[model samples]
Target chain A: MNDVLIAVMMIVLTIITYKGATLVYQRFRRMYTAPIILSTVAIIIFLLVCHFSYETYMVGGKWIDHLLGPAVVALAYPLYQYRDILKKMVLPVLTGTFVGAVVGISSGLLLSKWTGFSELIIYSIVPKSVTTPVAMSIAESSGGVMSLAAVFVMIAGIGGVLIHPAVMRVARLQGQIGRGVGMGSASHAIGTATAMERDHLEGSVSTIAMVLSAVIVSILAPGLTLLLL
Target chain B: MSKAVTIILQIIGLYLIYLLGTAIQHTFNLFIPGSVIGLILLFLLLSLKLVSERWITEGAGFMITHLPFFFIPATVGVMGYAYVFKGKGILLIFIGLLSTGLVMGISGSVAQRLAGRREKAHE
Candidate 1:
């Protein structure tokens, strides 16, 4: 197949899959239909059925990946829009995300160690609560596998979507800021997307929490790893 | 500005921020990702009134709404590590779920308390 044809096909297929998943998620409001998880599964199945090599799929996939940088930068818009709210809640937001990052990393490391996992696996899992780009970079620098870190990050996201409702209900977590910060710090982008479905305020708070957690974890992961390992 | 022009200009602005971030990362050897640096820079620009939100809102809104799509390729790339996951599947899932719950519970409760306290103080 021609490279241009392949690239176009990749982009088209991804958009279609994502749109379809979003529609299903909207209609059903189910965690399983969260666009990222659903589209990933759908694409994986399609590739497997067609015998497409992961490398070939990535030929066009890389283009989509390139957009992630710009998309992340675009997060400034929400941060900008909610600047006043952010300003008002700066103390709580910073305190919440910092605590959440510590809890997330400590719990992951403790659990992994309790289960007798190796040092590499423990390090990889430490940054799992953040978004993938930051998590992967932390994992690599900390002498862990980047691929494993990505998987753990996705699992954290999917788990957050599935588990948040139950946690919220039990904990009686009312108010947008509380719920949004919880989801974002725990699950990263997917959690933020899920929060976005609830309300704009929740989504905005989640974005802040997600971004702050990423920054905190990136700065702290290496030192923590050296201290703990 | 025309919508198309606004979108183009917004993208150019974002790319420029991203480039600035990359330059800083290379120079300082920061562990931070360039995109994140760009995000912080953009935030600073907006807060300082050096750049107006009107220039970026439409394009940024579109991108944020469809953010999950940008991650699909990377998520699909997880297939590359299938072999390593064979025996460790259960453990990884356990850790992911347990830690997610703990983080969510702890952060939510703490934030809610803090916000409630702040509101009461203001009142």
Candidate 2:
């Protein structure tokens, strides 16, 4: 079927773009050619030139979305593998995630308010630190702009890609858990991807950290909002 | 376990995870997704020795390896909002990017220092 062909083409194109971006990032480490950034540029061009609607693209892309649930569930393994270290750092991890999420969310809200942002914009901007999926949901539930939240999430990811290395270098953070947790919590999936490129261990830790960040942020965001308001 | 039995177990495991996740969400009034709650529940159960990692290993492992691929759908969804972001798109995108970068840099350094203290504390 023609639809199947488009689906296949969609995947192949995604792979090529991904690979190309990775090659660019690796080839120019310090120069910062993050694959997501480049791939996004490629996708935008493709969509514009082809005159394809986003919904049409969704038909192919949804196949990938179905995997998100299973994949998140899978994160248990890496955390399990690092169980001993996890146990030792449980308190610190919890503390760090709590602080990070609270500060990130509250600051965004306060800054937006101080700058005379509209209520809708404030709500959309508040959950910028949470993962994209959750952030979108929170924005939708609160009647904020889900699309704007998504854009914010992407921005967050790109930010992770650009700043992580320089930050690591400056802080002298060579350890796996520390680097990974930082990336995961701050940037979510994008940070995790960056960590994976740096090393497998860092990737695993980053994955855990990102999940941790999402969970903590989700739990606290609503309550904090209610309390502050 | 046999293949059929393993498949059955996976279905059961998924249901149980969902149920457990809902319970946690209700109890704590957590604002997160149910599935993520499921993840945290599963992690805690394993850590507490309430569940066998062996039981959930196959399904969970399969999920983790393919996690990165899952972002494709969400990212593609961005096309829908292309209108709102048209004029101020560049500025908005840059702000989001810069905020995340600043957070990552600051948090990464701080976590590292605190974790180092934790490591020393255990000794």
- Candidate No. with top TM-score: 1
Per-prediction TM-score, chain B alone: 0.84, 0.74
Which DockQ value does candidate 2 get?
0.39
TM-score to native of every candidate shown: 0.91, 0.78
Candidate 2 residue runs with Cα over 4 Å from true position: A23-26, A29-32, A170-172, A222-229, B1-30, B41-66, B86-90, B117-123
Query: Candidate 1: misplaced stretches above 4 Å?
Result: A222-229, B1-5, B117-123
For model 2, residues B6-66, the per-residue Cα lDDT tens digits are 7446645755786667677788876666667776777778888898878877666544443
iRMS value of model 2? 2.9
Cα lDDT computed for each candidate against the true fold? 0.84, 0.68
Docking class of 2: acceptable
lDDT of 2 by residue, A31-94 (tens): 2676666676677679778987777676676666655554555566566677776677766556
In TM-score terms, candidate 1 sits at: 0.91
Interface RMSD of each: 1.7, 2.9
lDDT of 1 by residue, B51-117 (tens): 8888788788777888888888888887777776678757778888999999988887788778876
